[model samples]
Target chain A: MGEPLLVQSPGVPGSPVVTVAPGWAFAAVAVLGALVVVAAMLDGALSARSAGGPAGGAARPFGEVARLMRQRRRTTVQADSLLWRIGGAGLLVAAALMVAVVPLGRWTIFDLDVGVMWFNAMDVMVWALVWLTGWGANSAYSLVGGYRFLAHGLGYELPLMFALVAPAIAAQSLNVGKVAAAQEGLWFAVWMPVAFLVYLLGVAAFSVWGPFAPALGSDVAGGVRAELSGVDRLVFEAGRYALLAAGAAFSVPMFLGGGAGPVLPDWAWVLLKTLAVLWLLVWLRRRLPAFRPDMFLEVGWLVLLPAVLVQDLLVAVLAVWRT
Target chain B: MDMSPGGIPLAEGGEDRDGLQLDVLKVRLGPVLPHWPAGLVLHCALQGDVVTEVRAEVLDAGDEGRDDADALARALDNLVSVLALAGWEGAAAQARRIRDAALETGDRPEDLEGLERLRRRVRRSWTLRWSLRGLRPLTEEEVRHHGLPPDAVGDTYDRLIRMMDRAATGTRQDDRPVFRVEHLALLVIGLDLAAARLVLASLDVHELQADHTQHEVAHG
Candidate 1:
C-alpha cells in the first residue's frame, strides 16, 4: 500500500520500533539557536566577510546585515503608501515561522506527527511571503523580484513534494522524525540516492543557489532586496539563514545517518553534519556557475521529476521485498 | 577587463571571465543637473602601453532603473567597446556587423508591425526571461491598460544603449537619482511614439563607440 506507516513494529530491548524521535529534532534546534547573529549582517559575505573558513573553524559567524541596520534608512518619496514597509516586515516574519517546523537533525521547534505535510505547507507559505516582499516594495526592481520568486516557486515546489516522499515509501512513515530513526539499518542515501541528491538540488533551487540564483544576485543587483534597508532587511536576511539551517536539519536525518555517530554524542554528530552540509553549500556557491531560471525549470520538470518518481518506485519494491 | 558596468578582476589567473585576464569596472556618478556638460567616467587598468583594461558606466542623460538584465547587457556592450578602444582590433567591428544585420531584419513597410518585430528580436531575448529573473516585459494588455504606449517597450533598448554611452561618464560613484526622468516620461507620452524615438536614437549608438566627452552624434 502507498500509505505511510510512521509508527510501526514496536522494537524493544534490541529491537527498535519505528517511532518519531522527538529528542533528535532538538539537535538541529541548537544550531538555529546559534546562527541568529550571522544572518543579520547585510554584506557579511562581501565587505563584512564570514571568517569561519576551515582555518578559522572556531571563528565568529558573518554579520553584514547587522552593520547595514545601523545606517540611516532611505525610501523613495513616491511611495503610494507605507505598504512596502509593512509588507516587508510581515513577509520576513512569516518565513521565519515557516522555518520553525522544518526539522534539522530530526529536531525542529516542534515536530508534528504529519512531518511531510508540515514541510509542504511551510514551503507554500514561503512562496507567498517572497511574492509579497517582491510586490510590496513598489519599485520596479522589487516588482520584478516578486514575480521572479513566483516563477522559482513553480520550478522547485512540486519536485520537492515527490522527492520527500521516497523515504515515506521505504519506511511507511510520513513523520520525518520516524523516517530518520528508521535509517539505523541503512541511511536513505544508500538505498534512495536519487531522492537524496534531488532533494538537495531542489532545496538549493528553492533557496536560490548555483545556476538557480538569478534572483537577488549581483547581476540583478540584489533583485528583491534592491530597495530594502535597515532592520527590515536584517530580518529578511536572518530568515534566510534560519531556512538554510532548517533545510540542513531535514536532509541530515533522511540522507545521512540522522543522529547516528561513533564516540561523539548524538547531538554533536548532528552539529558536525549540519556544518558539513552548510559548508558544502557555500563551497558550491564559490565553485559552480549560475544557471538561468528557464534552464532549471526545464531541468526540474523534465529530468528531476521523472528520476525521483522512479526512485520512489524502487523504494516501494524494496519495502515489500524486505517485509 | 574591458567593461562598462560590473568591473574587472585584476588578480592573475582569476577563475572569472572563463580565466581571461582583461577586467572592467562599472561606476555610477550621480543625480545630474541635466544642464551640465557630459563628462567621461573612466574605468582604467593598465598591463603596459597596450592598456589591458578599462570599463565605463555613464550616468547618462538619465537613468536605467536598477535592473540586472539591463545592467548586464549594458555591461556586455560596454565591455566590447572598451576592448576595441584598448586595441583589441576586431572586437568593435564584429559587434557592428551583428548590429547592422539585425538593423535590416527590423525595418519593414508597415510602421507599427515593423517596430513590434524588432522588439521581439533585437531589444532583448524573450527567452532571456527564463534566464534572468524580473526583467520580463509586460504583455500587450498589461502594458496598454496601464496607459504605456506600444513603443515604450523599445525604450528599454534605448535606455540601455543611452546608458552604455553616457551613464559611465555622467554618473559619479554617488550620483544617485530618486528616479529616471524616462520612467515618468513613459507615464506621459505612451509607448509607441516613445519606442520610435528610442529605436531611432539607438540605431546609430551600436555603430559608434561610446564617448562621453563628445556629444556630437558623429565623433572621433
Candidate 2:
C-alpha cells in the first residue's frame, strides 16, 4: 500500500509528474496487452516446433483471429443467448478493465486509490464470467466446467486475497502506484516470496491456464468452452489469453517493482518485465500437471492460505519495526 | 419422456446431493468429443456435474483381424488420445507424429527409434503419471476375473506405462486372450467424469470390441 495518486505524483517531491493523456494511455495499454497475448501464442507454437510437433506459422494467432472473424455464429435452442454473449465477450472486457489500473512505466489509465483492490475485484469477476460461459451453453459438459471453476475459485480465493494483502501491508497503501513506489529500494518478490508465489498460483487459477486448467480441461471435452463455436469460441478463448496477459502485467507492479530499471525508459522496462513474467507462466504449462480440484482444495486451504497469512503477518511486523 | 424447450431430450427427475428432488441430466460423453476415443459413447445420469450412473458402449465395432502393425498403430493412436487428454499438447503432437510415421514404415529400426523416444518421454513425464496414477486401480483378481490383456491388467498408470512399453517393443498376441468391454464399467462407474475419461483413455477402448451387435448376431 503506497501513496494514493489523487493528490500527489507517485515519486518523491520536487520531480514533475510525467503523465500521458488519457486516450494515449488507454490505447497504449490495449496494444501492449494484445501484443503480450500474441507473443505467448507464438511461444507455444515455437515450443511445439522444438518438441518435433506440428509447427504453425508465426502468424498463426493472427490467422486464427481472422478465421474466427469470418466464421458464422452458432446457436442452440433454449440456450441462454444473452448470458452466453455477455460471458463470451466479458472476458476480454474484464481483462481490459483490469489492465486499465496497471501502470506501464508509471502511466496508468486510472490511478485509483485502491488499484490493488480493483485488480483483485476484476479477477473475482472471472469466476462468474467463466461460470456464465458454461451455464449459458445449455449443455452438460459446460455446466460441469462451470461447477468445477466455482470449486476452483473457492480453493484459490483465500490465498490470493491474502497475497494481495501482503503487498498492501508492505506499502501501507492499497494503491498500485504506491505499492510499486514502495518497492524502489528492494522488490517485494525478494522479501515476500511466498506471497509472490501464491499470487502467481492465483493468477494461473483465475486465468485457467497451465495446471489450473481443469475448468477448461480436455477430459470434459474442453469443459466450459465445449459448446462454443465460431465467434463465440474465438471471443471466449481470446478472453482467457487476455486475462492471462492482464495477470502477467499486474505482477510487475505487485512484485517486481513496476518499471524500475536502468538505461531504458520506464515503459520499455515495463514491457520487458511483463513479457518475462508472461513467458514463465506459459512455460509452466509444459512443466507441471494440472492440479486435481480435490487435491488442490486441500493444498489451498490447509497449506497455501496459511503460508500467505504468515507471510502477511511477517510483512506487517517488519513494517511496524521499520517505522 | 419430457423434452427441454431447447428441443433436446431430458431424462427423468431424481434426488440430488441435497436430498432435494432434481432432474437427472442424461448427457452423452462422446462419439465426437475432442481427445475422446473414436466411436465411444457414454450415457450418463447426472445430478449436477457428478455422474450418478453411466453406461459405456461403442457405436461401431471395429473389423476383426488386426495384425501386429495394426495393433501398434492402435496403441499409438490411444497414446495420442491419452496425452492430449492429459493436456500435454506438445507430447500429444509428438505422439501423433510418431503414430503417422509408424503407419508409414512398419517395423523399421528408424521408426522403432522414434517409438523408443516417445516411450521414454511419456514414461518420464511425472505430470502424465501424476494425472493418471491411483485412478481406477484394478486389483489383480479383477484383472483375471474380467479377462483383461496382460498389459492392461494393472491400474490406469501401470496400463499406460505398459502401453508405452508395448508401443516401443511390438505387442505379442497372447494364446489365451481375454478382452472385454464390460470391464470398463468397473473402472469407470465410481470415478468423476475427468478421471473416468482418463481411465478409459488409458484402456484405449477404441481398439477393443465394445458393440453388442457382434455378440448378439453370433448368439442368434
Candidate 3:
C-alpha cells in the first residue's frame, strides 16, 4: 500500500518489497521449474535409497521426461480430449499464478492487494482441474480417482480456508507482503503452529502429494492418471511438483518469515527456505501411508477443522489485545 | 437403454446404498493390475466408487509347483503388495529388498536380519496402523466358511502384522486350504473400490484355484 518501490535497490530497501513489471513473470516461472526439478531429484534419490539401489536414480526425471516426450499419445474410445488436456495442463498454469503474488525477498510480479485470497482461489481451481482430468479420461478407474480427490477436497478445503484466515487476521491485511512483514520479531508459524501444520497438510492435499495421494493411488492402477501416457502424463506429473514448489514458496510470505534471514540476500533466503520446505515434503512421501478418503474425512472435520479454528481464535484475540 | 456411445455402452441407473438412483458402471478390476492377485478378476457393477455388485473369477488357475526354499521370499512378496497397496512406498521398497535378497541367496543370515528389521519397522508405524485399522475384519465363522487360513482371523492391520511375523519366523503352513476364486466376491461386496483393493491384498491370498463350473456369484 505504501510506495510501490518499483526501482528500490536490493539489500537497502525501506518498504522491504517492490512490485516488479509483469514481464518478469517468466523469471518467476523459471524459478518454479528449478524447484520442481530439485524436488523430483530428491524424491528419486530417496526412492533409490529405500530400494537399496545405486545413487544413479537421481537422474530419473531426465530419463522420464525424454521418454514421455518421445512416446506417442494414448487415447480412449470416448475420451473428452478437450477438457482432458485442459485439466492436464491447468495445474502448471495455476501454480504459476500462485507464485505471482509471492514476493521473492524484495520483488514480486503481481503485488495484488489481496494476494492471500488469490492463492486460495488458485488452490480451489485444483479441485476442478483434477476432477476434469479424471473425467476426461472416460475410464472407470480414472472416474473413481476423480471422485476420490473431490472427497478429499471436501475434508481439507474448509480447514485450509480457515488456516489462511489466521495469518490474515494476525497481520490485519490480506496482502501477503504485509503478512510476511507483520512477523517482524516472530514468525506466525511459531505462535500458530496448529494453523501452520494444517496449512502444510492442505498444500499436500491440493498437490496430491504424500498421504493425500489416494486419487493417484497404485491400487487403482495409477487412479486418475491410469490412462495418461507420453507428453500428457509428463505435463500432469510436472504440474504436481510445480504446485508443491509454489505452495512452499507462498508459505514464505504467509507462514515462514519471508526473506528474513541474516548473512544472505532476501531473495536468496526466500529460495533457500522454499528449497528446504520442498525437500521436506518430498522426503515425507515415503514416511506416511495414503489417507484413505473415508477415514480421513472424519479426521479432517473433527480434528483438523476444530484445532485450526481454535488457533485462529487465539490469533484474533492476540491481534485485538495488541491493537 | 442399450445405446453405445463411441462403441462403449452407457451406464444404467440403479439404486445405491442411500436409495438414490445412480449410474451403475460395469468396471473390471484385475489380473493385470499392479498390486492385484495374479490370476483373479472382479467384474464390478459400481455405483459411484462403491462396488454395488461384484463377480470374481480366476483365469488359467492351476497347480503351479511351489519352491520350499523361497517360501519366506514368497511371504515377503505378498507383504510387499499389501504395503504398496496401503501406499507406504518406503516400507514396500524395504520389503522388496529383503524379498530380493531372500530369492537370490535363499534366506541367508543377513536376509533374516533384514526381515527382522523390516518387521519391527512395519510394527512400529502408527500411521500404517491407523490407515488399515478396522478394514474388512473377518470373524472366525467367516474365515472358516470362506476357507481362509487361520492367520486371516483378524482385521487388515492384524493380518499385516501376522504376515510380517510369518515371514520373519519362516512358519509356512503346508496344509492350508486352496482359496477358491468364488469367495472374493463375497468378501468385497459392500465396500468401495479402494477399501476392496486393500481388503483383497490383506487377505494374503498366495494362490487362487479356478472354479471349473463357471458359476456367477452376485451380491448387493
Question: Who wins the lDDT comparison?
Answer: 3
Best by DockQ: 3
Ten-residue region with minimum lDDT total, candidate 1 chain A:
A43-52
- Best by the TM-score measure: 3
lDDT of 3: 0.86
DockQ for all models, in order?
0.05, 0.47, 0.79
Evaluated at residue A113, the lDDT of candidate 3 is 76
Give the per-residue lDDT of model 1 (tens digit) for A1-323.
12222443243222222334444334434547564443222223421222222343322233354476686776653543355655455543544554454444433444556666776676677766666666566454455455556666677777788888988777677766677778887888888889988877666665555445545643233656777788777666566656655566567766777678889866567667866776565445433334444345776788888888999888888899999
Q: Looking at the true structure's interface, with contacts defined as alpha carbon pairs within 8 Å between chains A and B, what fraction does model 3 recover?
A: 0.90
Write down the TM-score of every candidate: 0.56, 0.89, 0.94
Deviation in angstroms for A62 in model 3? Answer: 0.3
Q: In candidate 1, what fraction of native interface contacts survive?
A: 0.05
lDDT of 1 by residue, B1-220 (tens): 4422224332232223335553222223122311111332323332111112334434444322443333333433443333222212223333333333334343221321222332233225332222222222445674455433333243333334433433222222222212222332233222221122222233222212122212333343
Query: Which should have the higher TM-score, number 1 or number 2?
Result: 2
Candidate 2 per-residue C-alpha lDDT over B177-209 given as tens digits, one digit per residue, 9 for 90 to 100: 434555566667756677777778887565555
Model 1 alpha-carbon drift over 4 Å, by segment: A1-30, A36-63, A76-109, A219-221, B1-208, B211-220
TM-score ranking of the models: 3, 2, 1
Worst lDDT run of 10 residues, candidate 3 chain B, spans B211-220
